[model samples]
Structure formats: structure tokens, C-alpha cells
Target: MAKILMITGDFVEDYENMVPFQALLAMGHEVDAVCPGKRKNETIATCIHDFEGQQTYTEKRGHNFTLNANFDDVAASDYDALYLPGGRAPEYLRLDSKVLAIVKAFMASNKPVAAICHGAQLLTAANVIEGKKVSAYPACAPEVRLAGAEYVELQMDEAITDGKLVTAPAWPAHPAMLKHLVALL
Candidate 1:
């Protein structure tokens, strides 16, 4: 089993993001869910869940996935792969120098890095998406292109791999993304 480290955002997709976690666990891979900080009394970081008629803060949800520490505590040498779950967290994480450093380290090390939805935004900031084909939320098309990546509009269920990097559009694409990632593990 591969040691997989996942970086989560503050408002991650509750169910969609959980698919890969569940799959990795079932495959006996050691998965570490990391975030910016500890959330009080919550095993996972809590986030607002919007399901049409239902929307509220859901504790112990996907967004609530706890981390061992901030980006500083992690070293790129420690894991075989990295997964970034999309949400508002990427907006802030993308700007963090430490996080960008980690992302660069992963890319330079040729570690398998998987990013979805807005999480791809972090890659843009790291300047690691250049000359690659990537997919993300529609709003980020120009941003990805500006980073020198070719943007493709596709469903989340499809997996797009470029060298050791994997990307998907959004939550709905978790299945295929997770499947490809797990296989890499």
C-alpha cells in the first residue's frame, strides 16, 4: 500500500471528495488527510454543505478532514503521492508560500499529484501546470491557460493524466480520478 497524503480545503465537497478516501482505505493504503489547522472538537474539518434544498455546516464531513499540521510540517520526501481536494481552501492555500513550495517539491520529485476542481488553482500559483493538459472548474480556464497549460472541458468522472500529475474537473469526477490514483498507488 502506498502512503498517500491528501491536502484538503476549508469547504471541500463532502461526498464527492470522500470517494477517493474510502477507496484508498479499502485498498489498505495509508491515507493521511491534512488541512491548515485543527478544528475544535471535530475529527474532520467542517464546511458548509449545499444540497439544493439543504445547506448548512456539516461537521465530520469531507471538508472536516483533519491534517497533522500546516504545510510547514510536511516534507515532500515523506509521501508517495499528494491529493488536493477542491473548495475555498485552495483560494487561500494557493497564496501560501509554504504550500506552493510543497507543490513545487512534489512536482520536482516527480511524485504523483492529483488535483481536482478549484484545487487545480493551487497548481496555477505554483507555476507547475505549464506545458500540461489540465481540467478544472470553468472559471479557472483562463488562469490555467495563463499558467501555460492547455485547458480541456470534461466531466469529473474522466481522468486526465500528464506525466505524474492527475487532474479532474470537479466533485462528480472523483470516481474516475480516484480509480486512476489508486492504481498509481
Candidate 2:
């Protein structure tokens, strides 16, 4: 079983954070969900982002997600893979030096890294997507391209995998993204 590390923060997308964490566990993988400044058992409020025939997605408060690991205690070498779930969290997480360092460590080690939606922000901030092929939420396409990665715009349920990196547009692509991540593991 692979030891997977899921990095998230407050306001993380509800489905993006919960679905993968549970699905990975159901697949026999051990996942440690963590957040900066948060310890095991601590919870982070999550938000639900849904497209309701509006010009953009709608956001609502979601369930509180619990962390199972400590960020300060994490060593990228200790995990076999990384999961980055999209939400408002990435907007700030990408700015954290520690978070960027962890992201760099995973990419540097060639470990499988799966990022979805706004999660791509961290990859861009980490400067690890250069020369890679990726797919992200449409709004994030510009950033992905600016990071030197070829952004493949696809349906919400589609996913793109380039070597050890797997990316998807949003939670709607969880099935494909999770499948690709399992293969990488």
C-alpha cells in the first residue's frame, strides 16, 4: 500500500478533499491529510463549489475536514505520493514557503503528484510544472501556461497525466484522477 500525503487548508473544496481521501483509503492506501499549523485530529472548514447555471461556480460552507497528520512532522521522503485538492485554500497555501518546499520535494523526488482545479496554483508557485503537460480548471489555464506547462483544456471529467504528475479540472474528474494516481503508485 502506498503512503499518500494530502495537503489542504481551510475552505478546501468539500468533495475534492473528502472524496479522494476516502477513495484512497478504500483502495488500501494510507492517506495522511494535513494542513499547515494544524495537527492531527484538528479540523479545517471546507466549502462546496458548484456550478449552478451561473456565470461561475457558487460557493457554500461545507463540512469540517479533519487532519490525520502534522505538517511540521511531514517529510516528503516518508510518503510515496502526494495529493493536492483544489479550493480557496491553494490561493494561500501556495504562498507558504513550507508548503512550496514540500511540493518541491515531491516533484524533485519524482513521486506521483495529483493536483486538481485550483490545486494547480501550488504547482505553479512551486515552479515544478515547467515543461510538463497539465490540465486545470479553465480559470487556471493561464497560470498553468505561464508556469511553462502545456495546459490541456478538457472536460470537467477528464484528466491528464504527464509522467508522475496527474491533473484534472475539478472534483468532477475525481474518478479519472484517482485512477491515474493509483496507476502511478
Candidate 3:
């Protein structure tokens, strides 16, 4: 089974973070969920984003997810794959130099990476999506393009894998995204 590293932080999308973590574990893969400046067993708050006929998604309080690893101890080289679940979390996570370094390590090595929703922000910040066909929430397309990736617009429930990177628009694409991600693994 592949050893996966899930990098996430507070306000990460509820379904985006929890679903993949459990699904990957159910597939017999080992996943270490970590957050910057957090210790093992510490928890972070999650939020729900629902598209209820509004111009954009709406947010609500979700679960309090626990971190199973220490960010300071994470070595990108030690993991076989990387998972980046999106939400408001990526907004700030992309600003962390260490987090960006880890992302760069995985991308530069061509290790499989699955990023959904706003998670692509980190990839753009890491400057690792150049020439790739990546997808994210509709609102993120501009950034994805600015990062040099051809932003492939996908349906809400669809996912696209370009080389070792698998990307999707939102949590609705979990089934396809996970399938592609696990296949790469």
C-alpha cells in the first residue's frame, strides 16, 4: 500500500478533507494528516461549503478533525503521494514557505498529487503547475492559468489527471478524483 501525506489546515472543506482521508485508509493506504504548527493528535476546525443556488458556495461550521502527524517531522521524500484538500485553508497555507517547499518537493519529483477545489492555490504558490492541465473550483481557474497550467474546466463531479497530478473542481468529484489518485499510487 502507498504511504500518503495529506497536508491540510484549519477551515479545510469538511467533505474534501474527511472523505479522502477515510477513503484512502479504507483502501489500505497509510495516510498522515498534518497541519503547520500543529502536533500529533491536535485538532483543526473544518467548514462546510454548500452551493445553494447562490452565486457561490456558502460556508458553515463542520467537524473538528484531528491531526495524526507533526508538520515539523514531515519529509516530502518519505511519502509516496501527496493530497491537498481545498477550502479557505489553502488561502493561508499557500503563504507558508515550508508548506510550499513540501509541495515543490512532491511536484518536482513527479510524485502523485491530488488537489481539489482551492488546493490548487498551493500548487500555484509553489510554482509547480507549469504546463500541466489542472482543474479547481471555477473561481480558481484564473490562478491556475496564471501559474502556467492550462486550467481545464471540469464539471462539478468530474476530475482530470495530467501526468502525476490529479485535480478536480470540488468535493463532488471525490469518486473520480480518488480513483485517479489511487490508480497513480
The RMSD (Cα, Å) of candidate 1 is 4.0
Question: What does the lDDT read for residue 70 in candidate 3?
Answer: 96
Give Cα-based local distance difference scores for all models: 0.75, 0.96, 0.97
Candidates by TM-score, descending order: 3, 2, 1
lDDT of 1 by residue, 40-96 (tens): 233554454333543422234444554444454677788899888776678887877
lDDT of 3 by residue, 1-185 (tens): 99999999999999999999999999999999999989999999999999999999999999999999999999999999999999999999999999999999999899999999999999999999999999999999999999999999999999999999999999999999999999999
TM-score of each: 0.83, 0.99, 0.99
Query: Between the candidate structures 1 and 3, which one is better when assessed by lDDT?
Result: 3
Q: Give the better candidate number (2 or 3) by lDDT.
A: 3
lDDT of 2 by residue, 61-167 (tens): 99999899999999999999999999999999998999999999999999999999999999999999999999988999999999999999989999989999999
How far residue 76's Cα lies from its native spot in candidate 3, in Å, is: 0.7
True lDDT of residue 113, candidate 2: 100
In model 1, the Cα lDDT at residue 66 comes to 43
Enumerate clash totals for all models, in the order shown.
6, 0, 0
